[model samples]
Target: MKSLVTAIQQRDGRALQAMSNSVPLQQAQPVREHTAQVFNELFKQLRATFPASMANFKDQEDLNEFKRQWTKAFAENNIRTIDQINAGMKIARQQENPFLPAPGQFIQWCKQGESLAVGLPDEDQLYELYREYCKMRGWREMKWPSNACYWMVTKIYSEMRSKSLTDSEVIKLCAKELRSMTARIKSGETIPAPVKQIPQLYIPTSKERSLEHLASIRKKLNLNPKSI
Candidate 1:
């Protein structure tokens, strides 16, 4: 009986059936009742939301089988939260596609919805972060308000050091990095989180830019090398 409940929680059908076969009818009744409650509540909401998509489920037996299978799928995929369900529903409404998405598709949509953290700081905030990075020469670290900010500023620091970029060039590159990182985040890629690193304090000499390379960058920025 204990194993039966464990199997039910795991959505392990084979184990559940074997346990139920051994247990008395009264012993399995509670598990059956809970499964029914979840099934009825879960699919009714989905069915009502996308009735057109469920048109193929007109056969009662097939529909019941699908509900059973979907219950397992939801449990396996860890889609148990009200927030996750609502997020998937929200993504469904936003999609340009009129047809209801496949179960796997909806699962990914739920993930994307949850990725939208509240009040991600503006991309322009990278400017300040880049300035902060410029102040240190050793392997120091600091916090960023958002993932996008950390990524953009990291790029800014790397390019500034390796390319021997001027102030104007660094500013332009920082802006470009910010735009690119922000777009990637919007597209549902799990970019790195901005956890503040513990300072290591190791410093290394930076590579010098060739005169020709510096000249080219100045030209791109419409500045003459002779002006400096």
Candidate 2:
């Protein structure tokens, strides 16, 4: 029964269904009902987590279209194992590739987007969640972590790379450079030249720029910048 909870947590509905089938008919009925309830709750949490995206598909037709595809994929597929089911669910939940930021730019994303905390916890925390989920399923840890785990590792590496210049050793080296530069200036010696800035050319058009004019121009070009 606890395995069903784990399967649900892992979004392995097919695994849950398989586990449910293994139980006595009477037992399976109640378990299936409970699993279904849990699945609904998970979906509600997902919607809450991504309210902005969900809002875009608030219309019945769009919502139904999404549900229809989801249902058809789950129904038509024969998921033979727990892992396979897990993989399928992962594919379904895959978000459009989000823009990644450099360590210096991360602060800007936090300020600009609601997705700031989407992957709040580090990879270790998520791996712990996976362990707990697997334990509840009465399953032993696998010899190797799944591709999802590897994905987490990759994210951690990306974060580490982004912060490379801020590492203690690198920072110390930068401090040395600054000191060297300062000493040269103090000694009345010539310092290294600074980076040159290129001024951008700003050309103003004669046409008035307004919402009305923009709309007219867009209509003429048959282009919708908003769609981009």
Candidate 3:
């Protein structure tokens, strides 16, 4: 059951397709269906991951019984979605041993995944994306992971633009911001819509315009009451 799982993209020495977008998992596709499909996929992946540990289940009957029990236990623990299953597998892979985990222990892993159920990439992944966002800020068509990500990175970039900082310094600030945003999202707060960029009103100073130009509009001192 032990594997090295980092929620970052598979590239750049990370694991967990949790950040699957070219920008977020299995390439960033979310497993929203909480059904047998999810459970079956979880079993298949876990079996592949822990072939040695799960080798004891040599027959279909044994595997079926294991699935039945696990499904019931998972339901009791509210592990209804594949997102939670993916997270649980992530936790499972990070362990040091190859032994299969107890149902209770696996459930704990599933709980940890719940924290990630907001469907946002982990901090480090977002930081990497933020770096790319900075590099490609000039590109008119860049695919952002989500509106929340676009919003977060845009704010981060704006805040950092004036600072003379290194990657470490930037990541420190970015991580904090990412955490706050992730927490808000996990708490069911929707990312507020991006505000439209209001154009700056070009108001010329009194000196920028000639007094002659301003004086062109003459005002009459008295109204012509009798004239049409």
Question: Which candidate number would show the highest TM-score if scored against the true structure?
Answer: 1
Compose the digit string of candidate 3's lDDT tens values, residues 81-179: 667788889878889988888878887677555545666665677789888877776644557777787788887888787786678888886766765
Lowest summed lDDT over 10 consecutive residues: which window, candidate 2?
A: 107-116
List ranges where model 1 is wrong by over 4 Å.
1-39, 117-228
Q: What lDDT score belongs to each candidate, Candidate 1 first?
A: 0.66, 0.43, 0.69
Model 1 TM-score, 2 decimals: 0.41
Candidate 3: how large is its RMSD?
19.4
Tens digits of per-residue lDDT for model 2, 1-228: 687778888999799777777768876466455444433443464465456666777688987775544333333332122333332234334545333222223222222121112222232344354344434422343332333333333333344467764445443433333333333444565433332335556766656556657778778889976742
TM-score of each prediction: 0.41, 0.21, 0.40
- Over all chains combined, what TM-score does candidate 2 have? 0.21
Q: How many clashes show up in model 1? A: 0
- Model 1 weakest 10-residue run by lDDT: 115-124
Residue 33's lDDT in candidate 3:
33
